[model samples]
Target: MTESFPTVPLDGAPGMPLIGFGTWLMSGSECYEAVRTALDAGYRHLDTAAIYRNEPEVGRALRDSGVDRDEVFVTTKLPPPRADQADQVLAGSLDALGVDAVDLWLVHWPPGGARPDVWERFVAAREAGRARAIGVSNYSLEQVDELTGATGVTPQVNQVSWAPPLYDPAVEAGHRDRGVVLEGYSPFKNTDLGDPVLREVADAHGVTPAQVVLRWHVEHGVVVIPKSATPERIRANLAIDGFSLSDDEVARIDGLAEV
Candidate 1:
C-alpha cells in the first residue's frame, strides 16, 4: 500500500518528513530489522542518537535496503557529555552510520549548564560539512537565545518532549520566531494512550489513539518521531493522512493538558 506522508517546512533547512522513525532504547539486530522494515514501509526520515549505541545496526539496514542515501533523511545526536568532543563525536557518528554526513545533527542536551560553547562547535561541524543542519534537543528558550547570540546561526531544529500536559506554547512560538522547527519526541507521553479525550477522538475517527496524538502534532506544525518495533504498528502509525480532527476536537485534546 502506498502511504501519503506529510512534509513539514523546516525553517531554512530542507523539508522534513512529517513522520520519522525514532530509534530510542532499540539496539542490535532488533534495531536493524526495525529500521529496515520502516524503510520498506516507506519511512524516509530516520531519527537516532549517539547515546542509542545502535547507529551501526541502523546504518547496516540502510545500506542493505538499497535506498539512495540522499533519499533518506538520517538524523543523529551527540551526547551532551561529549560537548568538547563535538567534532570528534560527529566523525565517529559518521563512521558508524557509514556516511560522510548526516542530514541533521543535534546536541543531545544542554551540556555543563552552558550550551553556547557546545553550539559553537556544532556550527563548526555544519561549516565543515559534517552535518547538513545543526540543532539542539531538550533546550529551553534561554539556551536557544544564548546559542543564536553566540553563533548567529539559529538552530534549524529544536527537539523536545512535547505532549498535551507538557506542551509549552511560548517555547514553540519562540523557536518559530527564530526559524527553528520544533521536533516533538514522545508525542504519546509514553502512556495515556487510553486517555478518555484521546480515546474519544480515536473512536470518532475510527483510528487508534496513537494516530490521534500524531495528527495533533502534525496540525500543530511540529515534526514528530514515533518509535515502534512492530511492523503492524509501524504501518498503522504512518496511516494518518486520510483523516483530520475538527477545531473543536483539537481544542478538546489541547484542553486535556494539565496546568
Candidate 2:
C-alpha cells in the first residue's frame, strides 16, 4: 500500500508487505532500538509474538517512529497456553502493542494439532474487528485443511521456517491450492549464505549473499521477515528491492534444495 515495497494480497484481500521486521529474541531497549531502526529503514511490516514478551517494546517503537498506524502492518500470535483464553490474550496483546486492532493475528503453532476450538475464537475475533486477518504458523497443509473443514474458515497465511535449502515445490503448491499466503521466518537461520550458488548470484546482483537470499524469497512471492539488531545489516537486508534476479539464477537457487 505504501508503494515502497512489494506486497502479497492477504486472504480477505489486503496488501501485506513482502518483507517484514521480525522480533524473536530481541527484548527491552534492544528490542525497542532495533524496531526503531527497522522503522527508520522503511520497514512497513512488523512481526512479534506474545511469547517473545517484547510486544510492548515493539509497540513503543512504532509509536515513537511517528508512522501512522494504518500505514503499517502489525502481526502478533497467540501462545498455546493462552489458547483457552484466546480473547483475553488478544486483549493483552492489543494493550501491550497500543493498538485497537492488529493487521494480522496467528495461532503460534499447531496447538495440539489444528485445534479448531482456538481457531473458532480467532474467527470470532475477526468478526469482532479485533484483527483484520487471521492465519497460522508452523502448520501443515493437512492441519490447515482440518481447521477449515471444522469451521469453513481457512487460514489466510501460514508462517514457517524456510530458506532455499528447504525449498519444496509441493509444499509451495499446497499453499497455493489452498489459497493461503506463505510467510517465511528465520530466512537466514535456515540458509547457507556462504554457498557458492548464493555467492555467485550475490556477485551478479552487486549484493551480499544474504541480500540475494532475501530477494529469492520475494522472487517466489513468499513473505520474508529478516531480523537484525545491528543497524547496518538491518538496513542492508531491506535494500534488496533495487535489483531483480534472472530466471536462470532463480533456478540455480532452487536447485540448492537438492544439494
Find the candidate with the highest TM-score and give its number: 2
Error of 1 at 30 (Å): 0.5
Q: Could you give the C-alpha RMSD of every candidate to the true structure, in order shown?
A: 2.1, 1.0
Per-residue lDDT of 111-220 in model 2, one digit per residue for the tens?
88899999999999999999999999999999999999999999999999889999998999999999999999999998888999999999987899999999999999
Writing each residue's lDDT as its tens digit, candidate 1 over 21-89 gives 999989998899999999988888999999999999989999999887777888999998888888889
Go through the candidates in order and give each one's C-alpha lDDT: 0.85, 0.93
At residue 172, candidate 1 shows an lDDT of 75
Question: Which stretches in model 2 have alpha-carbon errors above 4 Å?
Answer: 11-13
List TM-scores for all candidates, in order: 0.95, 0.98
* C-alpha lDDT of candidate 1 relative to the true structure: 0.85
Candidate 1 — which residues are off by over 4 angstroms? 1-4
After superposition of all CA atoms, the RMSD between model 2 and the true structure is: 1.0
Worst lDDT window (10 residues) for model 2? 6-15
In terms of lDDT, model 2 sits at 0.93
